[model samples]
Structure formats: structure tokens, C-alpha cells
Target: MLATPPDFDVLIVGAGISGIGMAAHLEMMCPNRSYGIVERRADIGGTWDLFKYPGIRSDSDMHTLGFVFEPWKHEKSIADGPAILDYLNRIADERGIRDHIRFGHKVVLADFRPDEARWHVTVELEDGERKLLTANFLYLGSGYYDYDDPYDAGFDFSEFEGQVIHPQFWPEDLDYTGKKVVVVGSGATAVTIVPSMAEKAAHVTMLQRTPTWMFSRPARDAIANFLRKILPEKVAYAITRFKNIRMQDFTFKTARDKPQKVKDALHKRISKTMGNDFDLKDFTPPYNPWEQRLCLVPDDDLFESIKAKKASVVTGHIDKFEAGGVRLKSGELLEANIIVTATGLSLAIAGKIDLRMAGEPVKFDERFYYKGVMFSNLPNLAVVFGYLNASWTLRADINSEFVCRVLNQMEANGSDLATPVLTPEAEAQLEEDDLFDFSSGYIQRGKHIMPKSATAYPWRLNQEYLYDRKVMRKGDILDGVLTFTKAGANAQSPDEQLEAAE
Candidate 1:
């Protein structure tokens, strides 16, 4: 009851890939609505701008990572970080969305007023100035991983440390040149850093407690290149995107359905490339493929490094860190001048902003995701969380489209409030699943802080892109689960939704 009208119609958090895309979507779909973006950094690109480590590239194909509305013109489906950042900035400038972004402004807290159907957002600008702003809708495209907080392997590397570095905070000036480097963990970051750093380092050693599945792919997508040469730009891009998506879908399905067969094929490829002398066990993962994300090596760079002896792989547990380097559980000692902990990212949703509803702190675990975008009992909020199995932007673009649809639907209904609601009994009946079903340590560690996933429709988020494209992008907006209400009243009950549906 203590809430007032909002100044802006919407306020988007983060000015990265998701935020920039969200701005463009709003421009196309909600032209009448006034919105602004607040980014914590002084730059527009988020992750791409943040991670300056060498050899940082897209794990997934860029064709799918690129926004649906905007076609990717480049030949490489998997692009490097700087290229990706440049592409995002180009998008912002071309669309004229760059001006709407207020850099160096971080949203600290957002208090939702159910009565007033508004949000009072607290933002801290550069130079330590805190200010309050209000908006009718809040869209969070801040991304999943936290830049400031990265996951460590709980290594007692506390002692005898020789310039330990995290991929998240890769120092620009720190030189690994002509030094023996040991990169801990076998995730995407480690794999990427191993080869890139080996180019200059005296010798790079990749020490992994457990092996991760790696796929060697060409840096340049041959099929996409052929299509580009033969077909029109737009048509070629559309075809290439579709082909890549289908290929990813097929590969993922094959891995899931026939784990051993897919495993044999993948392991065979690696064993042949790396040669029998380089133990295949180092490339063999205990878990099935696609259980955790697959690591892609462009042009067999990682394998080439290992083959050329520029880099080596050591598979064992770390007993402790000694004076010079790491002591393995197998009684082997790895001597290194520098240690790079390419562990993984710490998941921080909504830029780690506090969400309060009616003066009460909102519990993420207590809330169910609505269509994987909006949280249950949360009004006029959309989150951009992409698919784990496919390209990130595939889901992000659809989520933006869905958010636009929600806004348009509310406008059409003359309703100022829209919230996804479920009966108490129904929510209680739903079974809880991990927000992300992956064996990745970062995801597992952050599960306690993430929102719980449900089993039923409107609550579950399918990882498949085609399914989401059908449901999220083309599904009915008047679904009974999403209740609409105008100002000066409480949200509609289950009976009201049923009656309206009838």
C-alpha cells in the first residue's frame, strides 16, 4: 500500500549479450514502452568484455549463440571472446540501444509492491552514489556466472603459491611466458588456457582430478562457409543455424541414448589424434558424454599441444601444494613457476541483487520458475537463462520474445499487473529438481542458492531449443497459470483464472 507509480515502464539489468539483445527486442516489440539499462561495469559487453584470458572462445556454435533477429555473418561458428564482444557492441550501436545503457550502475536491491504493482530498485552509480528508481517491470539479463566470485577446488594451495591466477580474474600484465605453468581443473577454461598459454610458456601441465570429454573441431565451420559462398547472406545464415542446431540436437540425443557407443566413438577419435603413447585414460571421462558440457578444441589445438610436447596432461588428485609446485596423491610432484586455477564460475543470479516482495525477502528456493523465465508469485519479471545443451542465445532470444509478448498481452488487457501463480496445494505437490541437471562442480556447488525446478508444465524448463521455440515463442499468452490483475486490487485467485479461461 506504500508504493507509488513508476517513472519508467521497464528497467533492464546488465548491458551484456542478454541485456543488449533485450533492448533490441523491446525496441522491436514494445516500441511505446520506455526502458533503460544499468550495467555494473563501464563497458557494454558483459562476459565477453570481462574475460580477457587468451583463447577464450564460445563453447557452443556462434550460429546459435547469435540472436535470432540478427544473423551472424562470420565463418566461425565458435568465435573468440574479443570477436564476440565486438559483435555485441556492433549490435548495440547499429540498433541505437547503446545510448539507453547506463554503465557503472549496479542494482543492489529491488522491492516489489504487490499492491501498487511496481518495483522500487536501488542502484549504485560510479563514485559510490546510491539512488532509487522505480519501474513497472524488471528484466534481469545479468547472466548466470559471477565475475567477481569464481569456484575454487578447495585446494590447500594456500602454502607455496607461485602467482596463482583464476581465469575469471586473469591479470592483463601477468606474464606466463617462458615459465612452467600448471593449469588445474579440466573444464573448458583449463582446456582453453592450456593450449593458449603453452604457445609462450616453457611447458604447460594440465593437472585434473578427473577427466572431461573433449571434442576436436575445426575453427572454421566448413558447411557454413560453403553455404555462405553459394547462397545469399540471410538465407545461408538461416540454413547454417538450423543445420547446426539439428546437429547439436542429434549429437546430444545420441550421447544420452547410447552413452557407451558415443563414448567409444569420441574416445577413439581422441586416442587416434593424440596417439596411443599418450594414455587414452587422460581423455576418458568417468561420466557419460553430455552429462557435463563437452569441451571443444578448435583445430585440435589442445591435442596438438600435447602431441607436440608443448603441454602435458596429469590425471590425479592433489595431495597438497609443496614449496615448488603441487604434490599429487600418486606421489608425483608437478614443478611449476605459475599455477592457473581454471576451475569454473560461481553462479550469481540477478547480479546478486536482493529481491524483496512486500517488504519480505524473497526465497529463491521457495519459488518455482514459470516457463523458465519468471519466478512464481513474482510479477512482471523475466530472467534470461539459456539452454545448457545448446547455444546460450537460442534460449535468451526466445526469452526476450516471450517477455515482449507478456508486456504486449498486459497492454492489450489493460492490466498493470501480471504474475505466475499456483495453488498452495499444487506447489506442494510438485517434485523438486536441480535448477541445472549437470555434473559440473560449479553448478552442483551453487544448487543450494539457485531456484528449485519443478516437474510439471509452466514450472519446468526444457533444455531443448525446438521445444522452447514452440512453447515459449508461439504458445498461448492467455494460459491460465499466468494471472492478470489491474491496479487497486490483489492478484486474481485460481477460480478467477479458471472462470476467465472458460
Candidate 2:
């Protein structure tokens, strides 16, 4: 008897930047391979759609963050949530990818059957109904963080009478005009909310336990705007993308190589922006820049708000929540009519889906990341995790392209499965390294759950884009590490096939 075939060649899990990019690549690269995207939410844009907070915008400029194939024609390189969503929507519509997506479907569990060389996925619909779908390959594009729950810092608000909010679940109808607001934390969200809320609020106070390193750049890229006017759209976008990628790489390298110099540069920039109001204690963090991602303040908005006395920063530990506001450990009380917890995100592995291999739960922390795309010993599965130091879409684009190549190679070679096989001998010889070196709260908290990494290439999820681009784009698929085989009784490892060929 013959085994059952999969419904689709590839089942992409998410409608976010990563999934959209993958679908676009498959359309161009592997046109014959049928695929479907199952988005948990009812909309197309993932993060952009979920986050409805005021002044929601892209931390990274759109040139590099935008898809490589798609040219971002927006005037502002650093665009807002709606603009980014529009860009993504346009891509889905123009490329005819929207027809392939099934919104309101959440992937709950996935089990790879080695015998059939297919993945049996269990999807839960929004109406609480469940259905089973099978696919030849599974691609997890459901971003890094938890969508259902943000990280809870365990602040007791029992004593406080004011409305407490988390930025992740911003209330759409809530009004803050003429109200005194307090935003907690010093991360990107807090910095963004502080300035944005200050614009309408009577006064905004940014309360943080520690200061985060911040750098301000114009919201609009003048060079990109200038180029768009003179040069062709594609050519101009390509140039700007190249420039931004190099600049991002250089800045990250400088921060790593010369910490003190980067620190001095950041201090000087912030000092100049804040002028006499700038205090060394409030702006200077104990750690170096890029250790934890630097907060990008567009057009000195945060500083301007502070200068205008519309917003203020308080550096202290929250002792407890009083009726009026948060009381500090330093015996100072910060008053507010509303409190916004700009606390960081909680990381989830494979979108918190129950991933199993041969009906057994797969332990991600025990597995190794292979070529930063797939995991060791995992067959026909690819994950889209972006760069930490650079724009996320950089990694997403490369990953999508690489996965398409793998699918194409499988077709050409008559192989049903491709797994990065790590034999016992090879695994024993490998040296383990921390998957991520950053000291950010979320990264550190979730380090134990992330896949393991080795010091060498192809065994680790690399942080450098320049090196990754060459290897992932041009490297051979049959590199001896990835074992390709057929299904059932005809199955044979790549080594055995090679021996037979010789």
C-alpha cells in the first residue's frame, strides 16, 4: 500500500514579515510547490496588526527592514505601524499571496512522521474547532516573542486606584488626553510611548530602574528621500538598503570592538540633544552599547518632550504602588493618573506550538541550530529567527530564500527528507556556546529555552549578516552535514548513497 501524500508542499505558520517573505520567495523560486499560511490572528500584519498603542513605529528603518524584493516607496524610512501594515498589505495583494492565507487559524501542534516524511499539523480555528492538516515541510515564521502574554515584572497594583496598562494590549477606546501618565521601563517601547503620550497628556513621566542607551536619528531619511526623487524606484531603494545594511553592520562592530569609543560617542550625542538638562547619571548605563539593544529616538522626540517639560525621567526602584502612583525605594513618589507598563516581551519557542518528532516532544534547548535556519536532527523544518543587532527582516529574507533553495534541491534530488544529522561522535566533539550573548532581560530570561549553538559555522545561529549571506545563499546543500534520504524501505542516508556512487 502507498503512503498518503501531504495536502501542501509547505505549511507556513504565520502571516508576519517572515511568512510573507517565504511565500513571496516560493512564488518566485519554487512556483510548483503549493503552500498555505495559517495566521493566528484575523488580520494579515502580525506585530503591526497586534500592537495598537500610540506612536507605534518601526525601530529599524524600512529600507533594510522591508523585504529585499519589495521597494519601500514611503517618504519616511522610519515608518509608523499603519504605514508598515499598508506596505505588507500591498505586498500580499500585489503578489497575489493573500489568497493563499487562512486567517483566524492557529497552529496548536505539529508532529513529523518519519515514515511518511510529512508533518501532521493540528490547527485550532478561532471558533474553537480543530482540524488536521498535513504538509511535506513545516516553516515556523511565528516570531520570537509570546503574543498572548507579555513578561510580567510582578508589580502589585492592588493599592493603586489608577488604570494600569500593558503596551502589548493597548485599549483602543482609552483616552489619555489631559491625563498625567507614567510609563515604566527604559526600553524601546517606553522611550517611544513617553514622547508620544507626552504630546497629548498633561504630563508624562518615564520611570525606570536603569537607564537604557539611546541614539536619535531623523524619522525621515533625507538621503533616501533625495535618491527616490532622482533615481528609479528600485535602484534608489537598492542603494539605500545597501547603505543602511553597511551602516548597521559598522555600528554594531564598532560597539563590540571599541566599547569606550562607542560609549563616548553615545554620551556626546545624548548630551548635545539634552543640553544642560542632560545628567550623566540618567543617560549613562552601567553596560556598554549594543549589549542590550539601544533605544532609537527619532528626531530627538524624547529629549524635546523633556526639554518642554511635557515629560520627565525618574531613575529609581518601585517600592510599591500607592493610590496616586508608584512609590520609589528612594522615598520619592511619582504621581500619575494612568500607568503604562512598557515592560519587555516574553520569548516563545516555535510560537509555543507543541512540536513533536515521531510522537515524542522535541526539546529545543537540547537541539543545535544548523546554518541559522534549521535545527540539528530536524527534518524538513525551517525557522525564521532574525538578527539581534540588525534589522530583523535581513535574516528573514535570507532564511526564506535559503528554505526555498532546500525545497528546490529536494525536488531535484528526489529526496523526501533533509535533516542536519549530528552523529554521536560529531556531537560529542562539538563545543556549545550561548545562543545569544545579549544581557537584555527577555533574552537572558529565555536563554534556557533557546536552541543550543556551537562555535563553528553551520552549527550555530550566526549574528553576522555579511558572513551568513555568502554561506546561506551560495553554500552547497549536500555539505555532508545535512542528510537527504527517501521515505520508507527505500530510505538511505546521504553517506550510503555517496558510497554506492563511488
Candidate 3:
């Protein structure tokens, strides 16, 4: 039996940070409009709520990760996962966004009916039932990570007798205490898991295919904390934010200009910290700094654990999984009771949405990206992407603001639909190689799905706050290939008219 169809002004998929932010903005912009956010999980916080692995934390500072309207009150800039999740949950509850979210409701497919000018959304309920919804607009706030499966690198684990766990699918009942744990992969998650598990486990071994460029920074900024005690909260946050931004900017510039110098400096730092115990060459990646990603070690804890003989790093290729352990290509078998695969996430663009326009299929591969906001030839759809250089929320904030402006403009112009259309020549000018060179699955999947821009600043993901403010906030919202379709002409209903006006 088909469940009762609920009609809404807007239907938002994924009740994560982006979805919550979008809901809040939509509510503020059009208070009378009826909207609903659907999430597959029982609660909010998306990835934060999903992952329960030890030592999970934000890669970026708390200030950057947090929403602009709500400042993070925590003293530590680099916060752990539980704290971040709490902050998100608090935001959802405080803003009354929890009511708008329909948990355990996963959107299966969304089809736009041009004649009706509404999106026919199909969702699966928790009770093995299917429900249909119709909305004038559809907004996807699902982040880039693949939530369906934990990243296991094509390893035939059938031969291995040890228990295997992916951090994404971490079991609540499983205990790692006194067990020899082997964490496979070289990334932020692996780096974090090794040190944290070493505290409880008998031994922790971090096996990596290649050494990641690792850098050490204190989890709690002592100077910032001192300043906070003396200065106002806002002032302290500003100072720390500026300091972090400038440091990141300098590092990015150095890596781009003098790659060898950055590598040499990093090599020296790692050697100085580890002395004879750590193998510097084995841990250093051959690629340029930031080519993959620089692993941030909190307070040299990973190294400290290695020095104490509780943890160790092994750099080699895994031949296969043996009965009791991993067999490396170098003919060495490392025994372990448990194996953790921190390989990486499989990227799904717009969370694998099937898009159609005017009853014709729209291939994302043939399309072009407009300022990273709108895809060419797409109508009334905008994808929110964050800055690669700065905090994810910084860019997300601007995107939200820009979306508000566009919405306001549409209302004022009495338009029912707006589509950004790019020229064929302009679209062809984009270079694929320079766009997303990252070897990760997310970047690889985005090659056809995401916008391909060569430059970083202004055109691409320039992390500069001032530049983004000017281009995204101050720039004209309807300047480019935006085609505005007036109401009634596109067969929009009276209800949609009332909703749009609201």
C-alpha cells in the first residue's frame, strides 16, 4: 500500500550540519513555508553521530567547523568527536530544527515533474514501508562521505582469523583492551586510532601503504587559552582564527612554491622528534607536500606512543591477509588479534542523486560548473561545497547566504524557476587534470560529478575570507547564465505560489 503523500514547500535530504543550516535559513527566510528534512539516521550530526571510533575529532579547528551564528564556546580549538556531536545536537534542539527533521526516513529517488512543477520524492520508512512526497523544491545537504559502507581496501579478509572492524562501523560491544591491534592505512583516522588504542590495547601497529606527511600541533593552543583568560571571547576567537588562517596560508604557499624546502623542514622536525627510534624515510611520502594531505598529530602523541614502545609504524605493501595476521610484500607477517581498515570513503556525488530536467536526462559529465555553486544547464538547484584551504563551514556560510539572496531575488522577481546555463566554449575550457588531482575516492568520483576549475582563489576554492565575501556575498546572484522562469508560465500551482511568496 502507498503511504499518504505529504506536500511540502521544500524537501531537504540528509539532516546533517548542512541540512540543519539550510532548514534554519529557510525558516528565517520564509517563516510560513512548510518544509521537512529527511535523514536516514535516527538522529542528527551525520558523520559525527555515525563514527564511534576512538580519538575521532575535527581535522580543522572548532571555530571553522562550527556554524557562524553559533560560536563554539569550548576552550580547545581542536576538539574531540563527542564534543562536536554535542554542539551539533544542542544547535538542532535550541533552534527547534529537530521538529522539522524526520529521522529514519531515507530518500530513495527524486523525480521532477515539469508539468506539475513539483518533485516526486520517494522515501523508505523504518518499518519496511515506502512513502511518497511532493515538494516544489528539493535541496540536498548530504555531505560528500559515503555513509553506506566503511572503506575496506579490496582485502580478502576471509583468510584472516582475527576480528576486523572499520572505524565507520565500529561495534559498541567490542573491546580492544589487551589485544594486539593492527590498523591499516595512512590517514587522519589511522593516525588517531593508533595512539588512542595504544593506551588500552596490548600493542598497536599502524601499517601504511605509503608514509603520509605528518605534522605536530598542540591540541590545545596554550597562547590562545591564555589570551582567552585575559581578552574577551570574541577577541580571542578572532585572534586564534587569524593565526590559524595565516599559518595555513603560509604553509599552502610554501608547498606550492618551494615544495622541497617544506619537505626538508618536515623531515628535520620528524627526525628531531623520533631520533633513532622512528624511520624518517619510511614515513615520508614521495609526493609533494599537501598532494595527498598532511596528517596532524596532536601534541606528538603518536610519536610519544612509539617512543614508549606501546605503538609502532610499519610502511609496506600488504600482500594479503593471513590466517592470524597481515602478510606484507616484503615477506613479513605481523600478528594481530584485531584489524582496523582506515582506507578511506567512497565518494558519491550529491549522495548519488538521479537528476532529470524537462523530461530529459542531464548527464553531469557533459555539464560545466558555475562559480562552484550552480551546474550549467541545471534549473533551481544549487550544491553547497566548502573550502579546501580553510574551515569547511567558512565557505558553507557564504553558500547559505548566497542561497538566501537567490531565494529573495526569485520572490521579488515573481519567478518560479531559475537555472544557470553555461556556454559550450566556456564549459570545454575546463581542464580535468588540474581540477581534482587527489587520489582519494571522493576526488576521483567528483571528476565527473563536480565542477572542474583550475585556479584556487576567486575562481576555484580560494580560502581567502575577503575574496569569498566579495564574490559570493557581494556579487550579483543572477548575473551569469541564470534563466528566470516566471510563475504560472511553468505550471506552478497556487500552493507553490503562496509558498514562494512566503
Candidate 4:
């Protein structure tokens, strides 16, 4: 008797940018493959739908953040939450990707059974029903942070009588109109909320322990808008995407090579916006630029709000939370009727899903990252962890396309399993490198959960988007690092075996 085949050739987790990008690639590149997407939420947009906080917008430009297969037709490159959700929705519907999605189903655990060359997946439906499914390949696009929990900075809000809010779980019925609001933190979330809340709140104060590096740019992309009017949308998008990618790479490289130069440039620009006496200490960070992600203030909104006296900045360590507001260690009390904790996220590996290999739980920290796409020694599995310095979708697009190439090659060679196997000698000689060099609180706290990285190529995430794009797209698959095999067969490079036979 013959055995039953797996339900799908590819099982994708999450319906976000990365997941959708993977499915799209499979359709265009490997048309013969069967796939299914499992999203925990009922909606299509993942982060876009989850984050409904006021003035929530893209921190990066849309041209590079958007998928390569689709064009971001909107006038504003720094788009808001709803606009981005709409873009995702249109892409899903236009390509019939939505039809393949299994909404309201959450993947609880995935165990890859190497003997059968398939993954035995355990999923929970919306109604608390557990179902088992099998797939030939497992693709995880489930972002880096925990969806249910935000980072608890362990603030004492018990004594404060006013409403305290976390931006991640912002209530829809929240009413801060004409209320005195104090937003805590100086990261991207706090920077976004202070100016937005200042519009309606009687006064909004940004209370921070330390300052963050920030710069301003116009929300609308004038050049992209101009090109769209004359050229086809795909052509315009291609040109704009290329230009923005180059610009992003240039800025990051310049900041890393000449930190003082970048710092001076930022200081001069901020002084022009906020004036010389506006307290440079509030915007100056202790670390150099690109060490932590820079906060992008669109159209100088945050500075303008501060200049208009609608909002203010207070930098000090919080001693405790009082009835009125937070009391600083400097013995000063900031008054507020509403306190917003725009603290950072609580990071997780592989969406906090339980990953295993043949019943043995996978300790991600022990494994090395392989080409930023798959984990070393893990077969038939791939993940979409995007670039930290550049746009997330840039790496997502490249990773999705690369995975498809691997799948197509596997089929051509009649191989059911593919793993990036490092020899014992290679592993011993590998130099350990930090997976992410970010000093942000979340990255620092979550470093223990991330996979190990090496100093060499194909063994690290390499945060350099341009270099990764070139190598990932055009590099040889049979690099001898990735070994392919049929079930119950000896592992070897398929091309090598073919040459030996010839």
C-alpha cells in the first residue's frame, strides 16, 4: 500500500508581509506547489491591523518596504495604518492569495519528522479545537515579537488614579481629548504618539530616561508622485524603489563610517527646526547614530508640536508613579491626567511557537543562522527575519524569492529534504558573532533567544541589505554547505552525485 501525501507542499505561518510575499513567490516561481497560509487573526493585515494607535505610520519609506511584486501607488511614502492595510488587502485579492489562507487558525507547534521528510504540524482553531496537518516544507514569516505581550518596563502605575495605556493594546474607545497626557519613553512609539496626542490633548509631555536619535522628512514623496504621473506604475515603482534602496544603504554606511559627521549633520538640522536654545540634550543620544534605529519624524511634526507649546520633553529617571503623574528621581513631578507607556516590544523567536526536530525541542540559540533564511542543521524549514538597519520587506522579498529557488531545485533533483549542514570541523573553526548589534532594550533583552551567527557570509544575517540582495539572488545553491537527500537516503549535494554517476 502507498502512503498518503502531505496536505500541502508548503505550510506558511502568519498572513503578514513576509507570509504573503512567500506565497506570491511560490505562485510565480514554483507554480506546481500546493500551499496554505495559517493566520492567527481573522483579518489579512498582521501588524497593520494589530497596531491601531494614534498616528501609527511607517518608520521606513514605503517604496522599499513594499513588496517587489506590487507597486505602492499611494502618494505618501510614509503611509498610515489604514493605507498600509489596504495595500496588503489589494495584493491578497489581486493575486488570489487570500483564498489559500486559513484564518482563525493558530499554529501551536511544528515537529519535523525527518524519517518521512515532512513536518507534523499542530494547529488550534478559533474554537479551541486542535487539528493535525502535515506539510513537506514549513515557512515561518511570523514576526519577531510577541503579539499578546508588550515589554513590561516594570513601571509602578498602581498608585496613579488616571488611565494608563500601552500603545500595543490601545483601546478603541480611549478618550484623551483635552486631557493632560504624559507619554513615557523616547523610542519610535513614544515619538509617534506625543505629536499625535498633542493635537487634541491640552498638553502632552514626553518623559524619557534617555534621549533618542531622530530626524525629519516630508511624509509625501514628491519625486515618486511626479514619476507616477508620466510613467507606468510598475516602471515608476521600480525606479523609485531602486533610488530609495540606494539612498538607505548610503545613509547607513555613512553613519557607520563617519558617526561624528552624521551626528553634526543631525544636530544642525534639528537646530534649524527647533532653534539653538531648544535643549539639544533632549534629542542627543549617548550612543552614535545607527547603533539604535533612528526615529523618523515626518514633516517635523514632533518638533512643531513641541515648538507650539502643545507638547514638551522631560528627561529623567522615573522615581515612582504618583496620583498626579510620574515623579522623577530629580525630585520633580510632571502632572498628567493620562499616562501612555509607549515602551518597546517583547521579542520572541519564531513567533513563540514550539519548534522541534523529530520530537527533540529546537533550542534556537544553539543553532547558527544559515544565509539568514534557514537555521543550520534544520531540514525543510525557512524563516523570514528581515533586515534591522533597512526596510523589513527588502529582506522579506529576497528571502521569499530565494526559498522558492531552493524548492524548485529540490524538485528537479528529486530531493525531499534540504539542510544547511556544517561539518564538525567547520563548526569548530567558526567565529562567534552577535546576531544583532542593537543596543535597544528589546534587542539586548532578547539576545539569548536568537540563533547564533558567524562572522562570515552565509552564516549570519549580515544586516547589509544591498550585499545580501546581490548574493541571495544570484549565488549558487550547491555551495556544498546545503546538503540534499531523499527520505531514508544518504545526504550529498545533488549536483555532486549526478557528476559522480556521469
My TM-score estimates for the predictions, one after another, are 0.96, 0.97, 0.89, 0.97
Q: Candidate 2: where is the Cα deviation over 4 Å? A: 1-4, 490-502
Better of 1 and 4 by TM-score: 4
lDDT for 466 in candidate 4 is 82
Tens digits of lDDT, candidate 3, 336-368: 999999888876667676667655666765555
Instruction: For model 3, name the residue pairs that clash.
Output: none
lDDT of each residue in 1-502, candidate 4, tens digit only: 0198999999999999899999899999999999999999998878888998899989999999999989999999998889999999998998999999999989999999977889999999999999998999999999989999999999888899999999999999999999999999999889999999999999999998889989888999999999999999999999999999998888888999999999998888888998888779988889999899999999999999989999999989999999998899999999989999988999889988899998999999989999999989899999988888889999999999999989988899877888898777888999989889889999999998999999998888789888888889999988888877777534365445434433
Where does model 3 exceed 4 Å of error?
Answer: 1-6, 27-34, 276-278, 425-433, 445-466, 487-502
lDDT of 2 by residue, 1-502 (tens): 1365688999999999999999999999999999999999998889999999989999999999999999999988889999999999999999999999999899999999877889999999988999999998999999999999999999999999999999999999989999989999999999889999998999999998899999989989999999999999999999999999999999999999999998998888878877755686887898999998999999999999999999999899989999999899999989889999998999999999999999999999999999999998999999988999999999999999999998988888777788999887998999998789899999999998999999998899999998999899999977888887776643266556434433
Better of 1 and 2 by lDDT: 2
Comparing 3 with 4 on lDDT, the higher-scoring candidate is: 4
What order do you get sorting by lDDT, best first?
A: 2, 4, 1, 3
At residue 334, give the lDDT of candidate 2. Answer: 90
Candidate 1 collision pairs: 62-77
* Top TM-score prediction, candidate number: 2
- Residues 300-395 of candidate 1: C-alpha lDDT, one tens digit per residue: 899999888999999998889987899998899999889988878888877789989888998887788888899988888888888888888888
Q: What is the C-alpha lDDT of each candidate?
A: 0.86, 0.91, 0.75, 0.90
